[model samples]
Target: MTELGKRIVNILQKKSSWESDKERLLKEIQQMEDLDILQDVWTRYERVQKNPDISGTRNDPNSLLAYYLDITKEKPEEEFKNEKRRTYGRDGWPDIDMDFCDDRRHEIVNFLVGKYGRSRVASIGTVQTLKSKAELRRVIKALDPEKSINYTAKKPDQSGNFALQNEILGTLPKILKKRDGTLLKNLQEVYNEFNEFAAYMRKYPQVFETAKRMEGNISSSGIHPGGIILSPVDLSTLCPLHTTRGTNEDGQAGASKAMVTQFTMQDVESLGLIKIDVLGVSTLTTIDFATKLVKNNYGIDIDLSDLPLDDPLVLELYNSGKTDGIFQCEEAGMKQALQQIQINSFDDLMLAVAMYRPGPKDYIPQIAKRKQNPNLVQYAHPIVEKHTKSTYGIIVYQESAMHIFVELAGLTPTEGYTFIKGAAKKKPELFMSMKARFIKGASKISNKQVAESVWRQMEPFQGYAFCAGHSYAYAYLSWKTAYLKAHYPVEFICARLTEKSRRRKTDIVYKYEQDAIKNFGITIHPADLNRSKLTYIKIGEKDLLRPLLIKDVGDKAAEEIIRCQPFDPDDLLYSFGMKVGGAVNTKIVEVLASAKMFGNIPKPKVLSIFEAIKAGRQKSKGRQTGNLKKGIKGTVKRRKKTLDLDF
Candidate 1:
């Protein structure tokens, strides 16, 4: 036998403790390998776990093997079963399967829920089981007239649908338990689960929080669309973690935040993983989409790729700080910040990109004064003047470190770049090695003191150090978004509002709607099946696009609404004869109607959105609730003139 097989046999013999036959254990292992199940069996075997033994053998490996296969085989069947049930309506309201699937059976859902808490499990939006449980629990609590009331119930203003579901689920102990409601245990109560998940969080908080925040949570208010999931395994297997996502989907996956590219260097080495930043940039998409419209509708394919950097109008917009509708500059505070910073050129945009964040935002005012008056800009050393003159003597770009290395340490351009990336990733060991190499390789005066000063400066610079190329690329995008916001604001806000509420609660969505209404003075619409464009589409009658286009609703819903336009369906999946709407799609439609998108179509359709309620139960179809849910609407006089394209 091969040494590997011999070792396996030897280990099995030792585990049996001379009572169990060696040949029997070896045969089991061989059988497992032959069935392509050795890895999973070994993986579980190596992992110590506690559970009631039902197979009547504590040390018998065969029981474990059987359990492993049973669970694994159960996984894909569950997945496909859910997948096969969805029905796509013509109006884009595709019936998403409200079911959870696991690749491995081994009580994976239970283990994950026990480890992460059911609420978090549901929040990630990946699993339907956890979502069902959480919703069931939520309803039981919500409608318990004896317990509490945060918001009024939709129907009869007396009975909450969630409350009713809670009652139904409370009795489910018998229905669910193979014994007593399948021994209904909250994943949290299953071995003190949420705390266990929290412990795991404590064990790997940086990675956990980073991974969690990157858009997988279905319960999360953020967008984790494209049916693509960026899981912890992929993250662990990829790059070192960082602060944030890029402006859109694909770019949202990887780490290190803005301006960093896939170019491998000292940063990746220090972080112990490849450093590839997938920037979640939506402005790029919006710009591309808008440009396509401009090309097809207006006959000018204004190539942003070839557009000259120094446009007077673009500069004037940047200089004025009317960045309200601008991509990076939409926040009122950002506008105030820009006015303080007095951005003038492409280089100014670069600095603006870096200084906007929490870490380096303090420098904005000082740099603003410097930019407004050239004489005020101070230089720590000649290197500062040399490197930062483009950004008005401010160290915004990570390139400053490279510049310092070249000017002071006498290193090559390439080596300086590597050193900067290393420092930025907070890799002290790699920095030390780079320091040694630089010290050893220097041809002329390599005074340790001066080199040490450069190193000290690089320390603060690393945390705030954004890639120069990324800033430049993003500055262009930021400026473009700002331009659209400023010039075509109606179109801009419509798109911006529909980005879906990323906060944990529906109230966050409310807050965003309020912001759009109060701060930006935009007319809000309700989510309606008829009036709202599938996604946020710029209506010919209005200067703005529709918020329905937000990733919250897909082209499926939009197409449904558009294609079924004038063929208004009351509830989601009405075409499919379903009472309860698709979970997310129903919400988006309701939101669009609330925004008043359906106001112009018909009186029945234009009824205030507060009238809409998700009155149903999410069941084996993922915990759903339904009943005549309702809300109040403030009276607003309709304008005689319809909002039309002003441009």
Candidate 2:
């Protein structure tokens, strides 16, 4: 083992006891003060030990060590005083502030498993419930004993057999809308418009009843996309464990057979298991690759966390609707909204992400108008203004609602958080109970009339809302990505292409390529067998597409081709096949040749050379087989003659 590895192991082994190990570990870590990285680790470890409830640490040695080593170092506490945030769950879990790349995130996860043992650390599972449409279809299938209704229609024309049910269920919006074109206004209005469909529904009322009963029922169980739970003891002692096979967001099967808790995230959390979101974000991967490219190609090292959040070029890119690959700001609607908002500050970016959802989306125009004319923005009361001023007097975030409850309603921070959580989750009982308490409390601080208006303002937040801290975290990443794209277009585009090239359809990468070439004036060279790596690479001012992006070239073959570069066609084929331990087929060579990857070599010539190499290998194999057969026959004859003589 390396010196560092041995030192780490030694530090871990000097444990006095389970409860006393913190002090021992800190003392041992302090001895390694000369190692700056270990000193940083010791600092974080000391902080975590001092405050066991520090959000994200969970007091587990593994969690503390991972947080200290992998998480991005934060600035002093005073720097973050202006932007206060909340931690909803137990302290010491991963959040957006960590800035972990996909690989680093997985590395931390693996470290947890190694530290706690696989049986004690497992990813949390989630239960997928049946939605309205799925429940309706299932109930219809069960009700129709003769299978008369063909509800699974691909087109409107195919709905002739079950037009009434299909049209009503399929055409109706997921969230009921009023005649005035506002969502969640009056749900009954949706059923009132079903003229003929009403008759069909009345005839089969049992179907509707069964569907309602089945809706929201657990349909299947799968591993949570990111949540990982660490048990204080063996996980099997708390919950049942099972192996689930499925792909993650990256469409990878490495975690297909990962052991997961049979219980859902809520179940594990309710059981007091410490859970952390170990999400694998492709944007972070893109940023990592982009920064590496910038450093290698331009000899410039970039610290994304330290990037200027108010760069004019980055804001201009957002305002000009040039955010095709920016995180969270790439959607067409988001881009259009950015053109109106003209993001100038980090707060604007935070509001943009927080307000781009369904409920808050409707208020975009009002927010934009307020941004354009600040005099038009108004609050129900001065207290409400304190919280809403940041969002242009608009309740664009859940934090705004929480602040309203705290400032206007005179509720404690904990109560305000509860109210916001209940409202965001649409918990009718908790929401109504909190509303009554809020009104009573507000009557003491502010008038009931103004309080009622403030309450109404917060009502829309129930539809959709995001935590202020989470929004800020995402906006920070979005700004970082935008900054990179604006200043380092070639590197950013190459990184985006590299990350997105793994998808089945290259449409996203293709669109990025078009923008890079047309908008950014970055030349995209075709994949070169000699120059192209496994991923897109920046060469001077031009970006070379990866050979793996070409059709019919698998990653293994591409790696082989890239490794056996600087060789002629015949030698290249021979070396590639020998290194890969497989045949270098003519089809791959033809693909490379067609892509103009072989310099001036024609496709026909490349194919001919490959075929000649294949023929020579076949001839050699035939000769070896013939000699082996002749030798075996002679040995058999000699053995028979010797046996006869012996007899």
Candidate 3:
């Protein structure tokens, strides 16, 4: 054994109370050595087949090694072990999905690129395919070269008749999603099922033929939002590579600079490459900003990781349906679900997150009813009850489904995962094979009728069951945001507004402003020359001074305005014009003036001030200007007519 392996074994020996645990740790350590990870096991790892690798599958929340390695927050002995079994040395690599603060997620990506050479890591690519609607539109535009049919115009086409193209495109039926969560019923299915669509297709035979041929064709290629493939060797040897400004990890409307693989994520995985998702969650950024605001506003440094999961104030906020700034609970339906479930604890929050999806959503009221009266809860078998008791006898999570498969059907953890994946991905052959295995094994433990009964019970919602670990993470984030908003309302809302402002989502920022003033008794101050910073900053307990709220005033202009503070108190207007003249133009000054940034100066007056500044500077430089007052008035009048002062 390596020195590091021996040290880890020794540490486990001291902490483990049972000899069996010591034996298990020693075996795992040996496995790590065989996998060539003993020397450097601090990094998160998942062993691949006998091949040397360092990527891993879902972590066992109750595993001693997982906890000891600091890979998971839940302790080894935590009561809720909803995570699936960690299958080391599995046949294939499992993609690792991780979330980070959106504002700083690039730091992690950069770190990965540096640690692993840039040649070894690259973002995965995705082929943008044409859907049914897009295909129909493309076919319509191509067939109508003479412009007889207008697709976008509300009026008739050039022939002065109703546009048949609009009717044909509009007749395309919506996709019918199957129970397995796959869109099995797409364009072809629409034609088979809907007579109106079929008739339309039959009428336009050429268009239908072309649309069908073009459907699902590659329209373009783009980098995957968050999938990065890591290889032991240079990635170019395995697949094609290209440089791209990859899509943002935060799911926002932006991209980042990175090296991207020409192959898609699935294609890379099929080539035995490991893919990891490093998603940028904007909520994490909001939480970080809120915590810093708390430190600055209240002198209290909030350690978010160390927060108690069961804060009553947080629960009260959920129960009251006041989840305006809380993550994941902002949707109206989710707020109603919180009230219906009467979520009063952390576990309940997690359950709400898991059961809020489509397949399981129908059971929310039933789960709530069962929660009120535990006697009403019923299970298919003792095994099902054992795994699903926390969720009130409903298989609300994929982990619970896996647990049932392990105990009732005697399947290995890996086999159970495969079964769940087959069902979720709508692989009929794989799902049937696993179902047969499950029944054969379950029949040995129990009767055939009971085995079939259990399968029937799980079949309806098993495809939509969420990952327990994912739901828990989301619920924890929700709780943290709620806690901050509940205890530090002003700071949290200010942080939210600041983030929205940075994104240039002015409408949503104004909506939040109304919510704050109306609901939280907080006062929002407009951009003040003396009090405002580059972003929103808190004044007193209840007041928040906004950054520059003028249109066309971006970060650079705002920075210049903030830098030139106390703008010539003696000659305020002309001095203001002189200081911010270079960064902002006359239109920007008009907008800022209308926002009252320059105190009661109207937009026309602000324009006149800028004109005066220009004229005086020209005169001092020995430039003769005839009719200077007339020139300033004409400039101000013309600017006033064109100024967009609708902040």
TM-scores of the candidates in the order shown: 0.44, 0.75, 0.85
How well is each residue in 275-318 modelled by candidate 1, as lDDT tens digits?
A: 11112344444554555555554576554434445667677776
Model 3 regions lying over 4 Å from their true place:
1-4, 7-41, 44-85, 88-91, 145-163, 173-184, 245-257, 569-571, 618-647
Off by over 4 Å in 1: 1-280, 319-321, 378-384, 412-418, 429-459, 486-532, 536-542, 545-561, 567-647
lDDT of 2 at 20: 43
Off by over 4 Å in 2: 1-99, 136-198, 201-217, 245-257, 569-612, 622-647
lDDT of 2 by residue, 1-647 (tens): 33664566565555444244455334434443332235334444554465432323111212323323323322212112111123233223222223345644666566567667778888777778887566666777567633565667654243433554575576566665656656432223434754554555677777766766676789988777667787779888889988766664222213665778889877787786666666667788898889888898879988764777778898899898889899998889999888788788878988899888876778888888999998998888987787778789877666677767877777787687677667766675666678888888898887889878888887767667666655756777788899999998988988888888855347787888888888888888777655677788777666555535577777777766666665555555434333332534667777777877655655675565445444445445646644543443344354443221110
Which of 2 and 3 is the better model by lDDT?
3
- RMSD to the native, candidate 3? 6.0
lDDT of 3 by residue, 30-70 (tens): 76566564543445432111222122213334345655554
Candidate scoring better on TM-score of 1 and 3: 3
RMSD of each: 23.5, 11.0, 6.0
What's each prediction's clash count? Answer: 71, 6, 2
Q: TM-score of model 3 relative to the true fold? A: 0.85
Worst 10 residues of 1 by lDDT: 76-85
Q: What is the lDDT of residue 573 in candidate 2?
A: 42
The count of residue-pair clashes in candidate 2 stands at 6
